[model samples]
Target: MSLLRRWFDPIRSRWFFQKPTRQEVLPTEQGLSIYLRLDDVYSYLAVQQLPQLEEILTDDLKPLKVVISDTAAEPPNGMTKTEWHTYCLNDAKILATQHRFSYDEEKPEQPTQEALKQAETILKNTPLTGQNFLYLLEDVFHMLWQQQYGKLRTLFVMASQHQKPQETPERVFDHTPVLASYFEFGGRKYHAVDDLLRLTRRLKQQKLLTDNPIFLINHIEWREHLMSDAEELAEIQAMHPELDLYIALEDPISWLLLAYIKEELADYYNIQMNLYPLSYRSRDHFDWSLATRLSKRAEVEFTPFCRPTADSILEMAHLFYSVPDDEQVDAMYEILKAVWTKGKDFSFKSHFQQMQQLLSIEQLTDVNVAELLARNDALCDQKHQPDFPVLELRINGKHYVFNSLYRVWMIESIFSNVLEQLYKSENDAENNEFEISKE
Candidate 1:
């Protein structure tokens, strides 16, 4: 059997191989609860798109808005305060461009408690409809982004006298201050443009799609941009770059990503690749269920994952980096496939012997292994990355970090300028060869 079939066949049979079933949504239960933070730019963007979304989804979208404080929001994926701010702001701008919305370049000041109270009053007074609520939402964002305190205060005061409490569903998590700009539907949370697309897909799957299926704005079609082999080879030959990947051996996503890079990206890019293996900050924070689901959905999914301990993960990293430079890639590939696909227990003496034999290594030592792991941990800290399987692409001096497999297309977008230059170089080379052959 082919290696691909060997790895994925078990997972396909055990996890997601069953006949497809359309999810059922009761008429009364069809509601999209949107949680918004008053000061969040992404929230404003989502609000802007809601009118069109409502038009498409029709009355089935039972819209509910939950206002929260951005200041009290938790940093997702363990990012530091500053790092989270930078990423959100930058990502918001990119999303705005994709959605054709004007994003303010300057970071807006945080709204005061008084401002939020006034805003709540307005929300309480205004009827929640596609047109009514969206207009009010736009005005609110304008007031916040433009720092129109006097106008905002007056509006709030005017609405306060007529304020009536608006009821909505209870919040999901017990986190004191909630994360901003997420939509919850059928017990799943989705945030931002990418996730909104996923949410739309779910609605369709549930047979809840309205007669008019509106195209989701700001949604980048990533799969359509996958380069052909000739194109990839030409680009690689024209412009060689480097890739630095931070991954955790215990992470199923990381293993899947490694397989992808090896099969689709390795030979196509004449680039220096650096793999930094890391341990999770907190194993409890890892979502095992989600990981399993994602692994099952992967094109080259592996099953029977042998969960590795922190020590075992570190040992694997040490062993991987200890191998000869020419043999490192093959060694890492074999190790991961064995562990995840074949369920090889890395902690066992027999498995260690098997790996050593596969790598043709006479002996292995753990010299400086602790120090190496510490260095990897320190790198994660420096980058303000709290998650595993992050791909950081450094071109010249700038680094772009991508946290999910879905964002691989963003990497291609980032390399567009270089790709263009490479394309021109390729054209010039072909022209030169043509002239020489004609002579």
Candidate 2:
């Protein structure tokens, strides 16, 4: 439901239904102190909304010293604030020629401990306002670039503006190190796979995976969704930044940092956030039509295999929410192997067909299809998962253990397995029916 309609509902409770407040909008720091703008949610999740403040706080970026600045600010009086920063960069350059500076004017020098201490003090005390930060960053970049341009062989950039929406793919050839593409959802058309793939290749040329990272800044539209095309641009960058580039998703880039941490510390700090699974709104939960399209477009495998049999669907559905009290979820593996082994003939497409037939049979078995449909609709309204304390049946008949979180994942797995079996069964039934009709 829309936010507006929720407020007007007769059962409205102000506190529970309140829209996001400013205080609520800001995320808290959990393991890391990663402060991000209220925007910047879409880089990770596929959902259309931002996570709760609690979830955001727990995100991987929580520990970084995040610096959020307003992109636009006018200068003092008649002049703009940005003008001053530009002027300062110019002044610093002019001063460097006349003043006694260390190292080459073009190349930066490695400082002594005392010099390092002084530089640290300068960085800490400098007022990094709208205009000044970039200039300061440029000076540092120039120094670093001169020192290791050949060795590093990478480009670093931070783009703050959104690219125009109507710009064609052909026009995107004039790409920079970090090009911000504007994208807004709700009404904007999705880019074609060819366009996206081409853009990804182009970004790869810019060394997205190199030591230098291209940062594309954009506004938050639908919480986790991008307000502009920056999401598209970022996606391209992520495909292959350097030879092995890393795309930092959220403001804090927890996964990127975790890749460096020792395994002991990493395991201790880990928590899975993408835990919940979307349930079926209708009897078509096993449908793979859309999944097939998406997987094909991405050039990735997305097959759901299963063995045929009415019993297997029920077993799979039961297992979907099933969890054992033991500490391991090994039982699910046994079940998967057993089902596929039994239905050796089932392929991905055939399995989906079986699922549709199974659901159809259930519907037909009911005396009142309309009444059952209504009840099904009601059930759909409530978000129910396999109740906690789920059970798992292993091949050895030895039960493994699971917690609520593990159970949630187990249910999804079972659903996939069950779909595979049911779909195959349905395809077999259809082939038989077709043969009979021809005879």
**Candidate 2, residues 394-422: lDDT per residue as tens digits?**
21122222222112222222223344565
The Cα error of candidate 2 at residue 310, in Å, is: 9.1
What range of 10 consecutive residues in model 2 has the weakest lDDT sum? 242-251
Candidate 1, residues 267-380, lDDT tens digits: the string is 665555677777644443344445555555445556664556665676676678778866776778888888767766566567777887888877686578767767877786
Q: In angstroms, how far off is 320's CA in candidate 2?
A: 5.0
- Backbone clashes in model 1, listed as residue pairs: none
Q: Model 2: residues >4 Å from true position, as ranges?
A: 1-213, 216-313, 320-323, 326-439
State candidate 2's TM-score.
Answer: 0.20
Identify the candidate with maximal TM-score.
Answer: 1
